[model samples]
Every structure is written in C-alpha cells, then in structure tokens.
Target: MKQISSSQLNREIIDLIQNHPEIDDFEVLAIDLSGHFYGKRYPIASLKSFASEGLAFPRSAIVVNTLGEPLEGIYYGEGDGDPDAQFSLIPGTLSVNDWGNKPRAQIMATASSGKEATFFEPRNLLKKVLQAYQTKGWHPTVAFELEFFLFSRKRDDQGLIQIVRNPKTGRPDSPTLLSNTRISDFERVIDNIIEACNQQNIETGAVSAEMGAGQFEINFNHHSDVMRAADETCLFKRTVIETAKKHGMMATFMAKPLLDQPGNGMHMHISVLDDKGENIFNAGNKPQQRLLHAIGGLLDTMPAAMSFWAPNINSYRRYSGGSSCSPVSLSWGHENRTVAFRIPLAKDGAWRVENRVPGADANPYLAMAVSLAGMLHGMNHRLDPGKPCDGSVENGDEYLPLSLSSALAISMGSEVLIDILGRDFIELYCQHRKADKVAFEQFINAREYDWYL
Candidate 1:
C-alpha cells in the first residue's frame, strides 16, 4: 500500500476543521475484506493526536466473515493472540460527512503490521497488482457502474422485502426500465445522492432507472488513478445508503436482494495506457492484439476469479438465468452485453473492455485487482480469446463455477492466480470463504418447513 505522511494527514484535518468548525466528531475507518467499514469515532479535540499516533485494530478483524465474526480455524484470530494492526488515515480522504443529523467528518484508513502491509488486507493485494503494471510502464483507467435497489423501510408481515411505492401514483412500483417518470418519482433521493457525492469529491456520471422495480444504476467518471476510483466507490456506497435513509427508503446492494427481481451488478470499465498515455487497447476501431489477449486472460481465469466477485451464497442467484442480465459463461464480444467481457462501442482513443461479471456486493479493490492480474497474464502468454459471438449465447453454467464451494475449490488450485496474488493470501481467503459457507448452511430457511411439514 502507498504510504501517507503524517504531516499530510495532519494538514488535511486542520483544513477540514478550519472549513467546517461545526464538525464535533471524527470517524476513522478501515475497509475489511468483506467490504464492510469498521473503526472508531473520536471527538474533534483528538484529531491532532489521532493523526500522529494511529488506532490499533485486531489483525484478525481484517479477514472476518461477512457478519464480522472470527472463523474457527483462522490463525490470526486466537493463534496470533489477536495482535493489533496499526491503522492511519489515507491522505486526502478526510472530508465532511454531512449525511447524518449533525455534521461529522470521516476518514478512510489503511492497516499495517510492523510497518508492512498485512497479508489479509484487500488493499494490499490491489497495490501489489498496481505495482506490477507500473513496472511495465502501463497505467489503468477505470470506472464503476453500480446497480442497486431501493425498498420501503417497512417489511411485509412475513418479513419479506417490499418494493417502494411510486410517489406519483401511490401504487406499488413495478419494472419501469429507463422510464424518465420513474426517475422523477425519486428525484429528491437522487438529488441528495448527487449532492452528497459532490461534497465528498466523488465524480459521478449518468443516473438512470434500471429494469427492476425501484432499481437504479449510477455511473462513476473514469479516473486515471485506479486506487482512487476504488476508494471513492467505497465512499459512494455509504453515501447512497445514507441518502436513501434520509428519504425514508432503504437501499441494498445485494446481488439478488429480491427473489423475483433482476439482480444488481457492478460493471467495470477498464483501459490500459502506455507510457505515452495512448490507450493500448485501441486500434483504429478494430480489435487490438493486446485487447484480445486481455479478454482471453480474463475468460481463462474467470473460474478462479469467481470467488472474488461472487463471494456470497446469494451472489450465485444473480446468474440463475432468465433476464438476470448477469453473465453465466466466459464469452466475449464486440458491442454485446450478453458476454462476460464486452468491448463497448467507443472510438479508437476511448476503446476499453467492460467486465460485467462482478456483483455489486463485491469488494471493489479485490475485484479490480484480479481483473488486472488476469489481463497481464494473458498478454504475457499471448493467449487467444477464441472467436467472438455475434448474437446472444445460451447460459452455459458448465463453463463457470456456480456455487461458492466450487468457486473456492477452483481458486485454491489455480497456480496462475497464486503466482499473481500470494499463496498465503489465496489460502487464507479460501479458508475464510469456506468458513462463511459453513455458517450459512447452519441456518434452516422457511422453505424447509414449507416443504417437509
């Protein structure tokens, strides 16, 4: 991970305090492997000391289950005596978080153990991949398009999810794909989200209604710095969640939040730039060799990379077929949305590949890292992506792992992935995921009672 000077962190806090004197509290947080933020809050008076001496978090906390519980066999939890992992704020991340009742400031931090990046940290994995790109004089430009759903704050009598009603018609909302009227119905919520993003220095692009009821997608502006893009994505998720609550609606990023509705996806747009700042993937409106190799690498490695994108049990439901808009095979094509890697219609200079396999629930840092690693692997070996499909392809579940257990098993056996990401990290991640699956299966759902009774 990139190091931030203590002096720079201090200056940022000072500037924030000078600008917003009403900020009575400060929150310092670190991103966990599950994409959840955990940290401590302090009064304004402690900001100065907090900048110099960082907070202490357990190293085990970095790789906990989605519920933030310590897995039984993980060595970091009790075997290591629960050692503290030092955390300091990332420079330029300190900003005013006014999405609350009272104005409070927040900062995103990174963890280090004895001045080295922790093996369990997702940010460290991404940093390692970025360094590999830097060695080859290549830079990656990336943007994330996140799809999510808004539900009523109240649930049904049976505790099932309920769609939010249309403010205009006062009726239960239904699929209103790309409907301008549907966007207008939630204008206030969208406006607040945009304003919140602006306050946090997050660059946003188009906002449109999606194919599912109360569903919408927000596109982020492309960034030359991939790390900043992932950082802003983490912040943007919090912004959308808080802003939705302000409007009496709850927002969810679950890949398949509702059983019958379309699943949410996080599509990544990525292009590689050479030292001369030329897009390597662009070749005069034709497919470039580098681009094809990159696609080939991604397709070949999708089975191993599945555990990173589809980390949860519910994530596989997104690819269960029937208008899910989720990719179920490792196909690639030009101007086709049905494939895993879509070379979207763009001019020569702006040409890039869009990876649509990741669910909105994935950790942005890890997802982007694995994608880059696969592309590099493909280019180094000059792998071919096979023939491009002209039309829609059938859902070939056999081409990819469709279960959490199967995905993790494939990930553990991938020598290419182990070479890109460290062996320790891969083993630890698979173990953690297996622990989560065990916990998930322990629960008896209502289906068991309905079917067996």
Candidate 2:
C-alpha cells in the first residue's frame, strides 16, 4: 500500500472539516480478529490532531473472540499485561457516516505497537500475503458477494429470532429465491442501505433476494487493488448493519442465524493479472495451466484454511445445512456452485475463480489473504488439480474439516499456512480459536436439556 504524506493528510482533513460542518464527531476503527470494529469516537475539535497523533487501545483488543472477550493463555491476553496498542489512520478511508442519526464521520486505521505493525492483525496479515504477489509483479483483482438475513427487533418467548415482516401488508416474509416481489417489499430499506454504501465510497452492484426469507445478496464491484477490496468489504458490513437498524430492521451476517434457514456466505471472486495487465488465468478464451495449478493449491490448503473460513462454532452449522451453495468438498468445476472453487464462464480477460467456502461471518481480510496465498503456492509448485466434476457432485476425493476443533487441529501443524501467514499469526490464531472452543463447550444450550430430558 502507498503511504500518505503528513501534509497531504492535513490538507484533506482541513477540507473535510470545512465542507462537512455538520460532522461534529468522528469514529476511528480498527478491525479485530472477529471482524468487529474496535475504536473510540472523538469530538470534531480533536479530529486534526487525532489524525497525526493517532490513538491507542489495549493490544488484546484486536485479538478478542466473537463475544468481545480476550482469549486466555496467550501473549495478547492473560499471559502478558494488556499493553496499549497504537493505530494510525488508513488513507482514503475517511467518509461520512450516513447511517448514524447524527452527522458523524468515520475512518479506518492500521494497527501497530511500539513502532512495529501488529503481526496478528488481520489487515497486516493480508498485507504480508499481498507482498508475495507484489514481488512477482502479479496483482489480484478481487470482489466479494455477501449474503445476509434481516430480522425483526423482537424475538419469541424462547428468544428465537423471527424473520422480518413486510411493512406494507404486515405478513411474515417467506423464502422466495429471485422474487422481484420480495425485493420490492424491502425497496425503501434496500435503497437506504445502498445510499449509505454510496456515501462510504463502497461500489455496490447487484442486489437480489436470496433463498432465505428476508435474505438478500449484495455484490461489490471488483477492485484491482486487493487490499482496497478487503477494506471496503469491512466497511460495507458496517454500513449494512447500521443502515438496517435505522430502518427498524436487524441485519445479521451470522453464519447460521437460523437453524432451518439457509446460512449466509461470503463468496470471493479473484483473478490474477500479470505485469502487462493481462489476465493470466485465461489465454485466447481458454483456461490456462496456471489456473488449474491455482485450483490445486486452493484444494490442498482448503483444510488448513478452513479455520479461517469458518471462524466461529456456528459457522460449522452452515456446512451441514441442505444448501447447495455451501461447498464442503475440495472440488472445482466450470460454473458449478456446489464446489469449493468454481471457474466462472467469462470472456478472455474476465476469467476468474469463485471461492465459495467462507461464511459471511468470517473475517474478510484473513480469508482473502489465505486464498491468495494458496494460489501463489499452487502456481509456484505447479500442482495439478484433478479432473473437474460434472453437474450435481456431492463429495470430492478429499473432504474439508467440518468442525471448528477439527479445522483448528488441521491448521495447527499446517506448514503451508505457517510459511505463508507467518508462525506468530498461525500459532496465535490456533490458540485463540482453541480458547474460544473451550468457552463454547462449557455453555449448555437449551437443546441439551430438551434432548436428554
């Protein structure tokens, strides 16, 4: 990433303050391991100095679990005294917080501590992976398709979540794949969400109703710079949640928010470009050998990368559900959604692979980082991807880790991931996830009593 000069940032901040006088406050955000934003809000008076001076939070803040609790038995948590972690603003992220009630602005920042960038930070991890491509004069153009469900604010007596009701007819929403009527029902809410995304500089493309009731899929425009694409994905999630809240609905990216409903997924589409700005995955409308090699690398690394894809316990539930789109096999095929990696049918320069294993709840930065790393490994080793499966294939030659514990165990000793993502991040991630697993196990859910009784 290019660094922004101090003078340039000063001028930009000055212009922002002058132009948006209604913005009386600003929120600086740093993405955590769980893909949640952690930061403090400051008054407009401190915006300028805050930019140069930066801000500080506990080092453990970036490594917290989904519940926002610091993991035990790690240097970031109880093992080491939680020290102050510093953060510097990421250039080009400052935008108006249009979803908020008051006129406020927000910006994303990079994590650091004592003059060194935090190795375990998800964004920093992605930067490390991108460096490998940078050294080889290869660039990745990437986009993410996010699926989510909207629910009513109220819950049943048992605290189970209920789907959103149509405001016009007061009827409960039902699953209707690609129904224009469903999309029309939520037109005002969807329009507001898109408007908010536009204000945040997030380029949103198609918006369609999905298979789950109150579910929708939004497509983000592709970016030549993979880092910027990941950054916008993070911001887009926040924008959706806040914008939905404003319209009296609750949007959740949880992997399995409802047991009986189709789960949310975050599918990634990526294509590599050579130094000459040519798509290396295809040549003269035919798939290149390098594309197959990349698929092989993704297949070999999928088990190890599974922990990152399905980061939470509930994420595993998505794979078991009867959803054809949630791929579990190490399979790849042309225009097939049932496989882990699908080579979409496209024109010469538009050829790309769509990775469909990650849940919407996974951290986008880490997920994309591991995916790109796998491609690099495949191309470097010239690995062969076995024959592509035909229509409606169930299982592949090998299966992915289905449980969080199993995924962690496979990733714990993965030399491929360690070499690509560094030993510190790999070990810390495993330890943190294991800690979360233990915490999850200790909890006794209602299902346990219902079954045993």
Candidate 3:
C-alpha cells in the first residue's frame, strides 16, 4: 500500500473514532532503542489538536542510549539539539491499547519536521529503503515469523529479580512436555493478543505452540511494502506483551533464556516482484540457484549485519552450535534450518528465502532495512554465492559471533554496510550500541554472569 499523507491520516483517525464510540482516548507511540514502546495518550476529543499542529515530543527522547545516557554534544539541542519532532498518526493502526484499563485507541507515529522533512526515525529509515526498491521499479514482499517465551515473575523470600521462571513448572523450565498440556493457562493471553491484532488490522498467517514450554510463534501475512511489514511487526510485539501482562504473565522477546532450550528467533522470509507484480525470484530457469547469489550477499554481510540481528548483549547466547535452528555459517540449503539461509521448497508465490540470523530481540525496521540493503548490494554487483551447503553449516572458522562485542566490531568494520546504510547512520548506531555494551558489562559484575543468562 502507498504511504498516506497527513491530511488523509487525520481523516482516517476521525472516521475511526466516530464509528467506534468505545475508543475514548488516542495513544501515540514511538519505538525506543530498547524495543520498548514510548509515547503519550490523549483524549479522543483532542485528536483535532494533534492533527492540526502535530504532536510535539522532546528531542532528548531519541538521543539517549538504551541506558538513558545523553551522548554529550551530540544532543543537537532544539535549533541545535534534536528539534521537537512531530508525530502524525498512521491511518490503519488506530486501536485501543489492550493493557490499558481505560478505553484508548493507539496509533503509530513518525518523526517529522514542519517543512515535511523526515528525520532518521527508525520507521522512516525502513521507508527510505523501500522507496529505493520502488525507484528501481521493483516491489519487495516480506513476512516475519517471530518466536518468544512466557514466564511468571520470580520472587524469593528476599525480593524479586529480573530472572523469571515458567509458571507451569517450578524450576528453570525446558521446552519439553509438561503436566499442563491443556494450554488453558495461556488461552486468555493468546485470545487477547489475537483480538488486539485484529483491532490494529494486523494479519496473521498462523499461530502455534512452539517446542519450548512457554515458547510460541506467530507468522504474519506477507506484505508487498517492507515498511508496512515492519510496522505490523512492531505493533504485534507490543500487543502480545501487553496482553500477556493482563493475564499476569510476562512475555519476553529475549533471544535465549535457558542454556539448553531453544532460543527465540525472528526468521524473515523475503521475495521480490517486478513492475508486472510477478515473482522475479521465481521466473528464472534455475530460480533456486539464482536465489543462491542473493543468499551469498546475505551470508557475505552476515557478520557485519550481526549488529542489526543481535542488538543486545543477551542476544548472542542464541547462536549455539548444536541448536537445530541456529545457523553457524554463511550457507544456504533448500529447507535446511542448519544453514544461515533456507529456501523453503514450495509453489511459485510461496517461494522465498528465510534469513535465520536475527534474534527475536532485534528491531524489525533495522533488521529488514539492513537485509534489503545486503540484497540490493548483491543484485547490483551480480555476485555469485557459489554453492549451498549440503547437510550442516557448522564450520568453526565460519561461525558467527559468540558475543555482542565481536558482532559490534564486525558491523563497524563492514565496508558494504557503510556504503549502503550511510557512514553517518552507521557511526551513530555503533556509538549507541558500544555505549550499551559498556553499560551492560558494568551492570553485570564478574560474579553475575550466571544470573543474567
């Protein structure tokens, strides 16, 4: 779908509230560095105020690192710092926040200036990359398969810690079968999540209980525009988390929680269509092999792309050698989860490549943008990826980063990433992530390693 303008967005919001009187307040949300939702809630009557003058938020909101530290002079205060950015609501995303006790409608917002200039907002970043595909007369479709875990808040005789445990099982949980096989405990949480998604017009291809005890996966319908797909993902995660809280449970997108259990993954399936809306990846005589080169680009840049895939320190724990779903190297095979990339063997339209590198903790917009950037680089250079791996991709030498520090270094050193994402954005991102890594290191003392894991 095409991007709607400010006036169109206003009309859509007004019509929505008018039709559904149940919505009393409108919540405008922005995604933060930690993948947390941050925004303000306004009464439905004040919708006109936002539509006319646009909602104003402090410049400092986007400047801070994940730990909320200001980066000194980089603040770029108002006329100099980050200007109070404007956030106009997205048309289709208007809905009530499921977790809120009061009646409220939620809308996704983008950072914009008075002159209609868009800044380096996370969502806008992906929009620019999608526009690049449009410039080349190509349309890209993407579907994300997201996996996460459920946990009950943990408490000791002393107090509560961030570490949680599965409610059904008393001890640290595993993915195997348990005493509670009825799935009744999670029924309300799942139902609320599905209902919230429906309210936001987010489409779900399927939802299933995963291998882990509280682990679950939700597959979204493919979208022709990458921005829409990312937006839907961001909204979906928020909905799931909020709904879970209502049921007195915690939902974590953390990549890996328990050592031996399966880590949560965000597997992205991508395909490109030409001007005629036909699958470009499927038209060739040897489509699977041709797609290999695209896979090559992904594998070639994966080390550097790790910053986007595993943004947090805890994220790297997901890349274990023996995990069936974890990819150890830059390799692709038909329907093989052992490799970094998998070409699902299916019909014409269903033909797509699944990049399994990213953790569930990744930022959807950045992950998708970096991935598209890699594919574009490959398509432009006409790079050949050689051959797909046969059985396993576990070459010790070719393995991805085992920690966040190594991943950050790879991202900073990537020339291809610099060329595509632009030097300024790369530098900014690196600085932010570095600060996060340092803070995390300090927060967890040498004796606390086991506690976090």
> What TM-score does each of the candidates earn?
0.96, 0.96, 0.88
Please write out the lDDT profile of model 3 over residues 183-302, one tens digit for every residue.
444556776788888878888866676777577777898888677788888888888887888877788887887675678899999988889987768844347444656777887788
Q: How far is candidate 1 from the true structure (C-alpha RMSD, Å)?
A: 1.7
lDDT of 1 at 394: 60
Please provide, for model 2 over 1-453, each residue's C-alpha lDDT reduced to its tens digit, 9 standing for 90 to 100. Answer: 224555666777887888998888999888988888988888978877867887788878888877888666767757667788787787778888766667788888888533553888888889889889989999999999999999997899999888999867789898999988988889998988888888878889999999898999989998998888999988888888988888888999999888788999999999999899998887667788898999999998999999999998899899886553688788899988888899988874588899999999999999999999999999999999899978866663445789998899999988999999988789989988888788778778899899996
lDDT of 1 by residue, 1-453 (tens): 233467777788888889998889988878888888878888989888767777788878887888888878778876888888887668878887777889888888887534553867878788889889999999999999999999998998989889988877989788978888888988989988988888888988898999889999888999998988999998988899999998889998999987778999999999999999999888886867998999999998999999999999999999884467788898999888888999998864688999999999999999999999999999889999999988996667685999899999999998988999989889988998898788778888899999997
Give the lDDT of residue 219 in candidate 2: 94
By summed lDDT, the worst window of 10 consecutive residues in model 1 runs over 111-120
Among these predictions, the greatest lDDT belongs to 1
Judge candidate 2 against the unseen true structure and give its global Cα lDDT, from 0 to 1.
0.86
Clash list (residue pairs), candidate 1: none
Candidate 2: lDDT of 404? 93
What is the C-alpha local distance difference test score of candidate 1?
A: 0.87
Model 3: weakest 10-residue lDDT segment is 176-185
Q: Which ranges in model 2 have alpha carbons more than 4 Å from their true place? A: 1-5, 113-117, 396-398
Q: What is the lDDT of residue 189 in candidate 3?
A: 72
User: Which candidate, 1 or 2, has the higher lDDT?
Assistant: 1
Error of 2 at 170 (Å): 1.4
